[model samples]
Target: MDEAARRHNEKMKRIKAARDRMMQDKTEEKGLIIVHTGAGKGKSSSGFGMIMRCIAHRMPCAVVQFIKGTWQTGERQLLEEKFADECRFFVSGEGFTWETQDRDRDIAAARHGWELAKAQIRDPAIRFVLLDEINIALRYDYLDIEEVVDVLLTEKPPMTHVCLTGRNAKQELIEAADLVTEMSLIKHPFRDGIKAQQGVEF
Candidate 1:
């Protein structure tokens, strides 16, 4: 072959090798863990997006929500009406953290929710789990970090995905996570004395 032909052949060889590697990587059985944290909005929103994506693919999903039980939104209503059997939604039942200042009680509630989530996490049929506001519960010591991490590491089936949402995720949890997304608050309407909009922030 001529010089130019030789160069072109080398490039083609490199591209083919890269393609093979990519295919192998895609075929590997790997689980995905996503953590959305920081003091900002959209943590739950981002996590919900993953839930929708999984459902679109006909994958079973489980959702365990800590705090904020009363104000129902489009997602809650839609999940209730549409994907009731496919997912599970649990509330802490005491509204916000400050409202339920009892640490022991809060921890107990979290433990109960975690127990339910543990079963879903182990189920190979369930492809995705969205642990909404779970990080905050861990940060506030409401949930046991060791127990959560153990479940994440051991209970997950092949190709299972998990999304955890809340503010101020613990360092250990962040370190253990595969993907960590921090939603930093740049500007919020609440700062301007505006109340949360219905169906948007809810």
Candidate 2:
């Protein structure tokens, strides 16, 4: 064998051995509070990906979309249509604040979505809950972050995984989360006057 190929094989063996050792004792399993946030795109997309994972595992899921407010999304369509037996979906927001142009209605919509989210978290039959765009609701002060965090941390069923997605996640929520992912925006097509494509962006 060539010297370079031999060295690469040895390096991969070492990496695999180290990874096996690190994973050996990770036996503890509990539902996780996962947060997806930051200025970049794919926050809700990531959360929906998790829902797909849960569906693959035959785990029941519930989704409450807070700010998109009934806007049609490909993920929403597929989950609701193909996986109707596996998931319950609710759209709470009328739309973004700027689009709706009504603070009272925005707040009401957020609160309504939050209530649906809480019900999902409390349902023992539901294995996963995604509060899509809830961070945006919190950012706009449409919902109380403290109360949201408290209920999420204390009241969710023991085996119910919960995911919150949006930009500007609350510090308290981040502190309480088991996993937090921040999507950093390096470049987006929209910056160059490209419109959002349906399959890619929605």
Largest TM-score belongs to which candidate? 2
Per-model RMSD to reference: 5.1, 1.0
The superposed Cα distance between candidate 1 and the true structure at residue 50, in angstroms, equals 1.2
**Model 2, span 1-202: residue lDDT tens:** 8999999999999999999999999988898999999999889888888899999999999999987755788988998889989989999987777898889989889998988888889899999999999999999889998999888889988778999999999998999999999999999998899998998889
Q: TM-scores for all candidates?
A: 0.83, 0.97
Kindly report which residue pairs in candidate 1 clash with one another: none
> Lowest lDDT 10-mer window, candidate 1?
86-95
How well does candidate 2 match the true structure in TM-score terms? 0.97
Report clash pairs, candidate 2. 69-93
- What tens-digit string does per-residue lDDT give for candidate 1 at 49-87? 788887788888988887766578677778888888766
